[model samples]
Target: MRNLLILLVFFATSFGFSQELNCNVVVNAQLTGNENLQIYKTLEKQLTEFVNKTQWTKRKFKPQERIDCNIVINVTGQSGENFEASVQVQSSRPVFGSTYTTPVYNVNDKDFSFNYLEFQNLTYNENQYESNLISVLAFHINMVLGLDAESFSKEGGDPYFKQAQRIVNYSQQENFKGWKLEDGLQSKFALIDNILSPTFSDFRTVMYNYHRKGMDIMSTNDKDAKNEIALSLAYFRKMNANRPNSYLTRVFFDAKAEEIEQIFSSGPSVDVTTLIDLLNRVAPTHASKWRNIKF
Candidate 1:
């Protein structure tokens, strides 16, 4: 990731675009058994350039401030230019005053099916409906930005999320599976809709408290930082009371379960008894990991 910083510096100095994402893209076609491997390589390269080179935000970010993320697309089938796939997108940010980089967003979109030709241009205009491929890439990039921002400040993610919502709105005209209400609970539509809805607003605060107020301060006082982190989980408890086993809660735990376990397991022994109970109640799906909290 450090090497990407040098490349980004060159980009900001050379091109006028203030690109904000340092994305590592992977296109896997092992399941397709398509002998024409060159096309997949081409697709990977083009998508890599599109994601890293395209400026997703208006705010200029220093090279080190660029968000670190990964996009993995597994190609299941290929019919000429049309491909059926699933994509996993995740992003992380460095903790202030620490070497740790914590996972912020980890989501898998299973309904990714797109048409692409090697060397074809992929472009995104928020107000327009382009290819599903472009829309999906743009959506995740904005989502990464939104989640990253939410970590820095309370609801700072709202602007980027609105951009993602716009992408969802226009992409709906194209009838993408992940952009509509009826696309199941795990759809991208439900994810962003829940975040923006005032009903689930506590989740955003949990982001700021958990990362900015908690992890960022860990180096100063592990006990106090852990306490702040445990207090943030109370927000999840309230959220679970209103909406049990929510898609948003599930998403949060997906990226956070392992880290939570590690944090409580090794840190200056804080009373995690209540925190453990809270985890079991709120993210019971991770009960196994919760059970592993030794301290």
Candidate 2:
């Protein structure tokens, strides 16, 4: 009877606490001071564990359902415990019916500065600002999940975005460097706020169609899939016309510019010139890529 109970316990433990993210954290310390290089190693290990182990949502994710993401931090300066760095956060989702994984969220955050002690515990409370280290990580983790959810369903990531906003709101009290509304338009607060605004709601729908309805069906019907994606480009034009050069617009281009070039490269059924004109209008930063897509 004791052996039977132990077997049941092991099985339950194995499946009980499934996390939602398989996140990789890398701290590039080549530019930092050598006196404390070992601490950066410790930071990388602890951060990886903290992100991968923490259950961000109550939903139990199977091993295969975990969102794939990477957070790379480039340490530029350090003074004792305080460090200044830039972070590039990226996440991708598997194309439905295809082996390709499409990039969803990719943004470079330049205002990440935090203080840390070697091997310190990383704990996060939604309502409190415990540490800038956890605040920055928590904020981006939620954003990744939120953006992934948006790709799967319309307005599906509202809860996660709200949670990210709550973190930003609570962190403002601590007077953190990157948590204020008045910070530059590219700050974390502005990013989340832009996502939650009603004017940008259509862009979320565009994301869903681009991934689920568009890319997912390309294997079976490449022409129709490309047409569906081309239809979605009008949404970008509308978004940009509504709010010219918004942060979210830039975020979309940052994530999809390369993919856009790939999708339209082979003279898709949709008018290539119209798409290029729209791309130039909506995402001028990638106009060169769009011009190359011209047939």
On lDDT, the candidate that comes out on top is 1
Report the poorest 10 consecutive residues by lDDT, candidate 2: 266-275
User: Please, what are the lDDT tens digits per residue for candidate 2 over residues 1-295?
Assistant: 9999999999998888878988889999777656357888898999999999987987888888899999998898888899999899999988988789999999899989999999888887777888888888899989999989988988888889999999998888776677897897899989998999989888898988998889999989888889889888779888887889999989988999999998888744567778888888988988888877855
- The number of residue pairs in model 2 that clash at the backbone is 0
TM-score of every model versus the real structure: 0.94, 0.96
RMSD of each: 4.7, 1.5
What are the per-model numbers of colliding residue pairs?
Answer: 0, 0
* Model 2 CA deviation exceeding 4 Å by range: 33-36
Candidate 1 local Cα displacement, residue 111, angstroms = 1.4
lDDT scores in order: 0.90, 0.87
For 158-180, candidate 1 gives per-residue lDDT tens digits of 88999999988988987568899
lDDT of 2 at 238: 80
